[model samples]
Target: MRLTHTGPAPARRDDWQTLKNLWPYIWAYRGRVLLAFACLVIAKIANVLTPVYLKDLVDGLGVPVAVLAVPVAALVGYGLARLTTGIFGELRDALFARVTQGAIQQVASQLFQHLLALSLRFHMGRRTGGLSRDIERGTKGIGFLLNFTVFNVLPTLLEIAMVTGILLWRYDWVFAGLTLGTIVAYVLFTLLVTERRMVYRRTMNTLDSQANGKAVDALLNYETVKYFGNESYESQRYDHDMRSWVDSAVRNQVSLNLLNMGQGLIITVGMTALLWQSARGVTQGVMTVGDVVLVSAYLTQLYAPLNFLGFVYREIKHALADMERMFDLMANHQEIADRPDALALQAKTASLSFEAVDFSYQADRQILHRVSFTVPAGGSLAVVGASGAGKSTLSRLLFRFYDPTGGAVRVNGRDIRDYTQDSLRAHIGIVPQDTVLFNDTIGYNIAYGRPAATQEEIQAAARAAHIHDFVTSLPQGYDTPVGERGLKLSGGEKQRVAIARALLKSPPIMVFDEATSALDTRTERAIQEQLDRIAQGRTTLIIAHRLSTIVQADHILVLDAGRVVEQGTHADLLALGNRYARMWQLQQSGEDK
Candidate 1:
C-alpha cells in the first residue's frame, strides 16, 4: 500500500518563544536552579583568577635563583585556584541535573496527553512512527539544551566580560579592542552559517521520520506484504527515504566543519596579534620579560572556551529545532471538547433516542439524513441494512464520537451533547465489529474492560462468551499472549474476547455492531443465546447483516441507503412481504446451501 504522508508540517517557532515556553517547567524547581547558578558563578570566578595567579607566580620566579627562593606561596595559590574552578564546576552539574530531568518529564508527559486529546480527525491523518520519533528527539534534546545553553552560556559570557575588563585596565587599548573584534566576527560567522545549516537539519529530520514510518507501516502489515510478495518493493521505498536522509545529514556535518574552521581562523589571528605586540613591547624595554609570559597565559586561558562557544551555539540551535516539533504537537487544538457547563450523564434506565438525526463525516458526503429512532428502557432494537446503509453510523452517533449535525441524541432523558463525553461513554459499552486489543495477555485484555475487576469475574465473562474452553486449553491459560493487536488469535477468537470484555463492563446500554460476523452458523447460535440472556433488562442496539441473529429483537428496522424502509417485529415484517421480507428470504436461501 502507498503510505500516506506524515502529519502536518511542524509549525514555525521563534527561539526566544520556544525557550520561554520551556521555562515554566524548569522553573518549577526554582531553589535548585538558584543553587546551580551560584555554583556556576563561583566556578567562573575561580577560573578567571587562575590566569591572574599564574602571571604573578611567573613574575615572582623571574629573578636570581637565590632570591627567587622557589616562590612556593605563588605556586600554591595558582594550584588552589585551578582546583577551586574544577570543584565548583562539578557542583554546578550535580545541583542542576534534577531540574533538567524534571523538566523533561513534565514536557513529555503533557505532550503525550495532548496528542491523545486531539480528535479522531487528527489521528486519522497521523503517522505513528514519525510522531514517536518527534517525541523521542524532542525529549532527548531537553537535557542537552538545559545543560549547554543554561550552564555554559552564562559562565562563558561572564568570563569574556572579566577578561575584557582586565585587558583594558592593565594593558593598551589594542589588546581588548582586538579581542572584542575577533569575537564579534566569530559570532556573526557562526550565526549566519548555522542559519543556513538549519535547512539541512530540518530536511534530515523529515526524511528520517518518513523512513521510519514506512518501515513500521510495512512491518505492521507484514502478512499483507507477504501475500502480495512485495518485500523488494517495500525495501526499495525505504532505501529511497534513507538515501535522502543520508545526503542531508552529510551536508549538515560538512557545513558544521566549515563553521568550526572559520571560527578557528579568527581566534588564531587575534591571539597572534596580541602575542606579537607583547613580545615587541618586551624587546623594546617598554614591557618586562615576565609581562610577556603574563600576556601569553591570559590569552591561552581566554581562547579555549571561545572555540567551544561556537560549537555550543550551534548545538543550541539544533536542540531548539527538535523541541519546536514537540511543542507544535502540544499546540494542536482539541477539536472535541466538553462545554464548561456540561454535566455528568445520569443514566438510570438507559433509554436511548435519536430525534430527526442527520450527520456527515464531511459536509459534501452525507452519511445519514433525517433518520430517527428510539429504544425504550429495558428494550432491544435491531437495525438491518445493506452495505453503506449508515447502520454503523448510528452507533457512532450514539457514542457521540461525532455529534449529529442536525437534531439530537438523548441518553436516558437529556441530550447527550449536554453531558460530559466521559460520563456518557461510561454508561455505554460496545462490541465493535473490528476490535483492536492491546499487545498483552488474553486475561489482561479482558480485565481492561474494568481494570479493578477480580480474576474470577474475568473468567465468568470469558465463559459467557464461550471462549473459556479455548483459553484454558492453552498452556498458559488466560496468560497466553495476544501479540500486537491480538494478531495471534483467529478472527472469531478476537470477536469472542471483545464480547467477554464488554460483558465484563456490564454497562446499562449495550451496542453490538456485526458482533457475530466472524463466527460459523453453529458457533453463532451458541453465542447468540448468551448475548440474548445478558441483554435482558438492558437497552440494546444491534446492527446485523445476518437475519437469523435479530429474530428475537423487540423491534427491527430495515435501513436502505440512510433511511428507514421498514419497521416491525420479524413476523410482522415477513407478513408485509416488503424490504425486510426480501432481505430475510435472500439470507435464508444462501444459508440453506
Candidate 2:
C-alpha cells in the first residue's frame, strides 16, 4: 500500500523546547557528570601545560646550547603530561557514555510506558510502524546531546578559554584578542549554517521513516501480497519510497559538504592570522623561535577540539529536535487516570448495565446513541446486529476501553469508571472476535492471564477448550512456540488457544465476541461446549454473527444503527419476526442448503 505522509516538518524552535523537557533525566546523572567534568578539567590543564613547558625549554635552554639535556628532559616531561591527559580524556569519554546510556534508557522507558498507558483510542488513530520509528528516533537525541555536548563541545570551548589566557600572559593582547574574535565568529557561523541545513536533514529523516514504515507494511502483509501475485507492484511501491529517501539524503549531504568546506576556509584563515602575529612578535625581539613553536603547538592542540565543536553543535541541534519529539510524547496528557482514591470493584451482583450511554470514535459521528441495556445476574445476554450497528462499541464500553461520552457503564450497580482500571478489568475476561496470540509457547499463551497458574490448571483449560490432546501430540507439547501472531498454527488451533487463555482468567463477567467464528464446525462445538459450562454463575455478553451460537442465550438484543431494535429470548424474538427473526431465518436458510 502507498502510505501517505502527514504533518509538518519538525521546527527548530520546537526541537529546542523539547530538549528543555529532558532536564529531569539529565539532572539525574549529575554525580557521574561531575566526575567526568573533573577528569575533563585535568585533561585540559595537562594540554595547556605542554605549551608552557615548550616555551620554557626554548627560552631557557636554547640560549645555553650546551645544556641540551635540559631541553630533552623538559620534552620528556611534556610528552608524559600529554600521555596523562590522553588517559584522562578517554576516561572522561567512557564515563560520559555511561551517563548518556543511562539517561537514554530512562527516558525511553518512560516514553514506552506512557504510550502503552494511553487509551486504546489513541492507538487506533496511529500507525504502529510510525510510532515505533518515532520512539527509536527519540532516544538518539539523549545520547547525541550528552556525548557531543559534554565531551566534545564543552571541552573545546574550555580549551579556547585556556589558550586565550596563555596567549595574553605570554605575549601581546593582539593575538589573544584575535583568537577570541575568530572563535566567536566561527561558532556563530557554524550555528547559523547548521540550523539552515537541518531543514534538509529533517526532511531526510522523515522520508527515512516513511521508507521504513512502507517496508514494515509490505512485510506484515506478505501473505496477502503473495496470494495476489503482486510482487512487482510491491517492489515498485518500495522503490518509489526509497527514491524519495535517496533524493532527500543527497540534498542533505550536498549542504553538509558545503558547510564543512566553508568552516575549513574560516579555520585556515584564522590560523594564518594568529601565526603571522606570533612571527611579528618574534621579529621584534619580544618573542623567540620557541614562542612561535609554542603558539603553533597550542593552536594545533586547541584547533582539533575546535573543529570537532562544529560537528558537535550540528549534532546537538539534531539531538534537541529528537528530544522535543520524545518529550512531546512523554508530556502527552492521556485521558486522566483513575483517581488515587479509586477502589477495587466490589461486585455483589453478576450483572452488566448501561445507563443511557453515548459514545463516538470521533465527535462528528456518533457510533452509539443513548443506548441502555441490562444483563440480569448470572444471565447470558447476546448482542445480535449487522456490522456498524454498535455491537462491538457496546462491548468496548462494557470493558471500559473507552468511557462513554455521556452516561455510564456499570457492573453490580457501580460505575465501572469509579473502579481502578486494573481492578475492574481483573474480573472481566474477553475472547475478542479478532484473537491474537504472542510468539511464545502454547502453555505460556494459555497461562498468559494467570502467569502463576500450575501445569494442571493450564492443562485443564486446554482440555476444556478441546485442544489438550492436540497440544500434547505436538513434538514439544505445551512448550511449542506459536510463531508470529500464531501463524504456525491453523485458525482453529489459534482460536482454541485464545479460548483456553480466557478460561484461565476465570472472570465472573465473560465477553465472547464471535469466539467460535474462526473455528471449524467440530472445533466450534467443542469451544461452545466449554463456553456454555463457563457461562454458568457468570454474566456473559456475547456478540454473535452466527445464529446457532446465541440460540440458547437468556436474552437476545437486536441492534440496528446503534439502537436496540428488538430484545427477547431466541424463541420470543423469532415470534416477533423482526430483525433478530430475519437474521435467524437467513442463517437457517443458508444451513438448509
Candidate 3:
C-alpha cells in the first residue's frame, strides 16, 4: 500500500523506448490510424490553404477587380473550405476515440485474464480497493494516450514543422527562423514548467488512490461500523483522506494555471510582434497586402495548436505514469499453470490419502507437520482440533489451494499434482465455514454448482437439503432475490443454501468445514442431521468444533497444535481418557450444569 509521491523525469531515450512498448497495440489497428491520419493531414492542409483566399480578397478588392460576385464567390469558397476541413477534423477525432476505446478494452481484457491466472496467495496480500484502482487507472491510460497524444499532439507537431518550412520557402528566412526559435523556446519552457508541476500532480494521484482505498474499505464493512456505533469515526477518517486529496488538487491546479498563463502571454506578445512586422513590410510595398493577410491567418492558426500542445504534453506524461503501473501487473509472472500434457483424473476410486504432508502460510511456522492419513473409499472421517491448529489448512491442501510445503497428497492412488488443477478440484465439494452467496434468485444460487442443471434436478437437490419448503413459501418462491451476500437470509438459511449447492455438485468427496460451529444449538442440530444424510454414501471429511456433532463419525482424528495426538471412535476415545475425552468432558460438563 505504499504510494508513489513523484515520478522520475523521462530521460532522452525514454519516449522512443516507451513508445516501442506501445507499438504492438498501435500496429494492430494501423489501417484505421492511417485513415484517420490522412483525414487530419487533409484538414490541416485545407486550413492552411484557406488563408490564401482571404489574402486575395484583401489585396484585389480595390484593383480593377472582377465583378462583385467574384469576391463574394471567393469568400464563399473560403468558408466552404473551412467548413469541409472542420467536418474532417471532427471525423478524425471520432475515429481516434474509437481506436483508443478499442485499445482500452483490449488491454483491460488482458489484465483481467492475467489476474484470474494469478495464485490465491497473490490476492491474499493485496487490498481489493487498491487492486481495482490499479486496474482502472491502467486501462484509462490507453485511451488517453491514443486519443490526445496520437491525434492532437503528434499531428500538431508536424503541422508546426511544415508551416515553419513553408514560411521560409515562401517568404524571408528571418520570419521562418524567428517562428522556429519561438516554438523551440515555448516547448522547452513548457516542458520544464510542466515537469515541475507534475510533482504535485503525482502526489495528488497517490492521495486519490488512498481516498478510493479508504472508501471501499469502509463501505465493505458498513455493518461493522453500524453495530459498533463508529459511524462518526469512519466519517471523520474519510473526511481526513478527502481533505488531503482536495489540498493536493488545489496545488496542482494553481501550478497548471501558472504554466498556461505564462505560455499564453508569450504567444500573445510574439504573435502581435510577428503580425506587426508583416504589416510594416506590406506598407513599405516590400510585401503585398494579400501576403500579409495570409501570414496573419497562418499565425492565428498556429497559435491554436500551440496552446493545446501544452495540455496534450501533460496528458502524455500522465499516461506514461499510468502505463508503467499497468505494465507492472502485466509483467507479473502468473502462478504455475497446468503442464502442457496434464491429464484429467480417471475416476476409478474415491480414496484420498496424505503422505508425510507439511505446510505453512508463513515460512518457519508450519500449520500441518508430517501428517499422514488415508480414508478408504466412501468412508467418513472427522478431524477435531482447537482454533488455528491446522484443521482448515489440511482441507485447503485436499483442494490444492496450496501444494504441500513438503511431501504429497494423492487422490485415487495418483499424486494430486499429476492432475490438471481444475480436474483435481472438480471432484471435491466443500461447505465452507463462512457461506457466501451472490445477489441472485434462489434457484440461480442453488443451480450455481451445475449451471446446466434441469429445474427438476434443482428442486430435487433443494428438497434433499431440506430448504425447498422454505424456498417455496417465499413470495417469489425460487425466483426470490437474495440481497448482496445473501444478507436477507439468516445464518442457518445461508448454510442450508450452501449445503444445497454442494449436494447438487454431487462431488465424489465432500468436506464440511465447521458447518454448524457458529449456529444456535437448535439450528446446529437441524443442519447436522441434514449433513449426516448428505454424507451417507460419499467420502466425507468434517472439520468439527462441537464434539457432540461428530460422535457418529466412523473414525476421528484428534489434532493438537499441528500433529495428530490421538485417534479413535467416540467410545474408544472416551475410554482412553485422552485429549478428545477431555474436550468432550468439558463440553458435557458445561451442558450438565
lDDT of 3 by residue, 355-390 (tens): 999888889788888888888878888999788789
- Of the two candidates 1 and 3, the one with more favorable TM-score, higher being better, is 1
Indicate the TM-score of model 1: 0.94
Q: What TM-score, over all chains together, does every model reach?
A: 0.94, 0.94, 0.89
lDDT of 2 by residue, 189-234 (tens): 8988898888776776676667677677778778998999988887
* Regions more than 4 Å wrong, model 2: 1-8, 63-80, 346-349, 591-593
- Highest lDDT among the candidates is held by which one? 1
Clashing pairs in 1: none
Report the alpha-carbon TM-score of model 2 versus the true structure.
0.94
The number of clashing residue pairs in model 1 is: 0
lDDT of 1 by residue, 1-593 (tens): 57444344344569888888899998999999999889888888888777777776777777778766456676787798889999999998898989999999999998888887787778989989889999999998888899887677778888888888887888888888987888898889989999888888888788888999889999989999999999998998898888878888999999988988899899999889999999888888877766777678777877777788888888888899988888888889887788899999866568988888888889998888888888999899999988899999999888877888898999876889899989988888899899888999999999988999999999999999999999999999999999988999999999999999999999999999999999998999999999999999899999998889999999998888888888989999999998888888888888421
